[model samples]
Target: MTVSLPTISPEQQHALQAVLDEFGKTLPGCSLTVASDSNVLFDGRSGKFDALEEETDSPRAASKEDVLWFASTTKLITSVAYLQLVDQGTLTLDSDLSEYYPPLREATRRVFRGTDDQGQPIWEDSHTAVTLRMMLNQTSGFGMEFLEGVQGWKSYSGKGTGFVNSCKVDNLIHTPIVEQPGVQFQYGNSAEWLGLILPHIVNQSTEDYMQQHIFQPLGMRKTTFYPFGPEFKSRLMPLRFYDNEKREWQVLDQQMPGLTLPRSREEIEYPVAGGGIYSTSTDYTKLLQELLKLFRTSPNAYPKGALLSRESVQSLFQGSLPESAKGLLAHVMNMRPPQPGDAAATGEWDWSTGMVVWTPADGRRLGKDTAAKEGGWGRRASSVGWFGAAGTMYFIDPESNLTFVCTTQMLPGDHPSVSTMRNALEKQVYVSLQA
Candidate 1:
């Protein structure tokens, strides 16, 4: 199952570049790479690595080599790492989390009913058992400590919200459950919990395990949860916030909120597993390509051995929600403002292992009708994809046998500019593919 490179005509390349320039011009910087398995079809970039400011001498133009914060995109890698554990019989998807970590057994599952007349928080005990599957699918009732529901829980319990970003499991474990397990889909602390508890199961730091299992194997040298040293800083894109009044992007004076700058490599302790990795578009494309390979090829196809079995990869891509949770998941996906020139919503989405399982307008499943005319706006139905909080996004489309990675260093990831660029770029990629 050797993958051959797909050729992009010169006309198609030019058209893709034009889309990048037009849609990506406003942002501080952005890069997009579209590929199938091993070879890149198109790579285009626009804007500068840093927004031009009075203090800036010469801003570096955006390049494929730029290191950008992957933010929540790190969750996919964490998910992959844990799935590898499952492959090795270290744990199963149904493994009760309490068995590995006893605190979960003792921790009371608290659901916030609402506020009482005196502004006190009403609560209920959820007796549902937490499972690895529930954690990966984000149905574990974990709420982000900084968000509204969890914030109220913090006030009511007198527990500080510092644990959300501190990356410490002890504090994170104490964060109250904001909903009942297996009741609904809430994208909160589930990924972080997956990452924190990983070390306990593997008897190694998360960084080491991921390096040995995922990053090193995939040759993603630039990707890491702990991105330290001057070399990384020199290439890292500074997080930027757009000022509507000034009509310009402003560089954040400090690291993104909740992230503390590491003084040195040794100072790295609790890495924010959910949103802490820094990576280049090139490095991340390797991961996407590897996933595509796993989805399309068999085990013996790799002489050196694949990262995970095909069955494991299938589990990662398959939708995990039951009928009960689909309504709530759709509501969350619809809350984001639609990107300009975006595809019409099918009003359908569900959580896979660590990605969103989006049913394309065509409703075609992979391997069902290979001859179907690939009718879809962007991604094919059932494609597994997710975005970083800092505007990075990637999707592995098994139907088209393609993978896409777009990177930008902007805050409030759902900013219309970033979202529009991502959607437009994806549409253009499909256009080029058709050509």
Candidate 2:
């Protein structure tokens, strides 16, 4: 099988640069890498690191080496690691997770049905068994802590909110399931459970296991669940918040709540599998490129060995949602912040093993709906991508044989500015491909 590598021409590079320059004016700093399966097409950055910009006397230029908190982007990596267990025949996606982990069975898996008339909690025992597929694919009924119902459950149950970002098992046990397992897509602490159970399955700490299996094999040397060490403190990109009223980027006084780096060995627990990795663009790209290669190749012709088997890699892009959950999944994806100057709903969204998979809406496939066809951030149908809470976005388009990673350190992950920047960059990637 011959796969011709696509190159980004000078004119296309110029157009991509223009996107960074245009949006960079509002963001504190951002870096973007566009690459083919085997080569980098465009690698560019705009703005300055807040740490350097603060030094008014002599501002140090922001380098491409800067590390950014990947937030939910960490899920893809963790998902791959868990799938590796399946590849080794140690775990099965459809097996009841409770049967494998007694803790899950010990904890009551009740569905929160809201308060009774007297303001008392109403709960229903869920007979539906939770599976690894449900957990990784966002259908485990675990609602994110920030969601209104989940927060209400926390208050009613007298559970502390700090566990939301603490990377503890309490994140899953203490949190209530909003729906029955395998019924709907409720994005929350489900991935955190992967972090909790993965160590037990592999007989080592998640950090050690990932370091041995994923980080080292993929050459992600700078990526880690623990990024607060003295070694990383200097290279870490500071978190920033955009002040809409002030029209300027402000360095956040504190990092996102519940995020703490361990100073001593004993203090380390399971790393936050949902969103606790810090990585540079180059380091993260290696993983994407490797996955892209496996994605495009047949099972018999997988190029270099990867963390996941070719079958597992295929699962990453294939829709895993049941018929019952498709509507909810589409609604959730469509709820993203509106891109500037663009007024079309994102068509037909699905969750694969890890990330969001954009597909053609019913009408789009028949060419009856023009808007649905244009709504996938300019990436073709079946493109897979997801966003990080800290203003980071990436997508891999096998149809175009291109992948893109853009990172910025900003709060309120769904801020319009961040989406606008990402949307523009994504659209430009396709434009470059066509040219």
Candidate 3:
């Protein structure tokens, strides 16, 4: 297929480079790549991936070729896999999810009211059927790994607050319906559940499933959910974070992730559907290009070699949060974009299948005002697609036909500096496109 790549004027290219330079000054390690419908407009890597080397007056420069931890950005990729199952007739999006995994069906019958005399969660049967659609939209009643240490979830996990590892449950977090499904949006566990189900239904681990279908088909040789294979360099941009109190950056010494290709692959206890992919901007961009073609092309004439069918692709962009879910989202006021100024542009977001869909306010423009069709930019007007975490972000702008993938390895996922750099970088992309 011939792709007419968008050409950035020389002035726009220089401006983009300056924007990257500004971020390099603030962030110790950062890399960014932006693409239009057909080609990469700007791909910049700067600063040092090794925070410790800074103290010794030497640092490994972040390179454009580096494959970083994808974190939650993997969600969008996994979302495509789920819809592929729908296209293959292996699973219906609306089918009772439990029809494939009997355990999920059994889980739906019970509700976690409180603890029993044995301190285990007491369950009462409920009639709610867990559906694939609900799981895709994050309405599944599942908790995330972060909830492991939270007091409330720990108590719910039946392990005391000091619990270090997963208790009796299969995954780190408990898997009962903490909240009623389809009533509102709950992330984290829904993707995990889907990740768990796919392997069971297909009798192949999701890592294998994705490689055979999404990765191999799309020519994404480096993208995977587990350890880097022997063909690939073992080096990954090490995870690091700024220690506010110590006023220094530190590398995170975390356990090697679960899904390794060979000897290390056995270490993977489970695939985290929500956040476990390891990839480069190049490999991931291929996936985004497929989605971009689906977004811009006619439904009847769907782009050839697209990951999902026309119906599934259309459904993906459609927001899943109902009006009733708005109030629940309101309580999440603690959420903020990476940069302080970006909260306005980025905060007016809604949950979609596996991405956050951005919208504008009524009377005022949200942060970065982009074009919309038919009317004022309301929730239904313009949209954004992404899932970000641990200093990694993949944002797709349907309006401008732009996609941004920024990767940095860091801990305490919500670090203001990490996001500050990301938000600034994103704002610059939109501004440059307006040129």
Residue range 68-104, candidate 1, lDDT tens digits = 7888888888889988888899899888877777766
Per-model TM-score on C-alpha atoms: 0.88, 0.89, 0.84
lDDT of 2 by residue, 1-435 (tens): 244688889999999989997876557558889887789899988866783265376555567767788888999998888898899899888867776567665443788877877878888898778889999999888876667778777777776456556555565666667788888878777888778777678889888898999999888889988777788877777777666677665656554554433333355566778888888777888888888888887767775556688889999988888878887776666577334333224346778998888666532221122454443436666778888888888888777787889987777667787777887787777668778
Provide backbone clash counts, one per model: 0, 0, 7
For model 1, the superposed segments whose C-alpha errors exceed 4 Å read: 1-6, 54-57, 108-115, 118-121, 166-171, 253-269, 298-304, 337-347, 360-376
Candidate 3 lDDT, tens digit per residue, 292-396? 768778756776656788888877777777665555453442276432433443335567766766555543333433453333222223455554555777766
Off by over 4 Å in 2: 1-3, 51-57, 106-108, 168-171, 251-268, 303-305, 337-347, 362-377
Cα TM-score of candidate 3 = 0.84
Global Cα lDDT for candidate 2: 0.75
Residue 339 local lDDT, model 1: 41
- Per-residue lDDT of 60 in model 2: 54
Compared with the true structure, model 2 gives a TM-score of: 0.89
What's every prediction's RMSD, in angstroms? 4.0, 3.3, 4.7
Flag clash pairs in model 3: 109-126, 226-259, 258-268, 260-265, 338-419, 338-420, 345-367
Model 1: how large is the Cα RMSD against the reference? 4.0
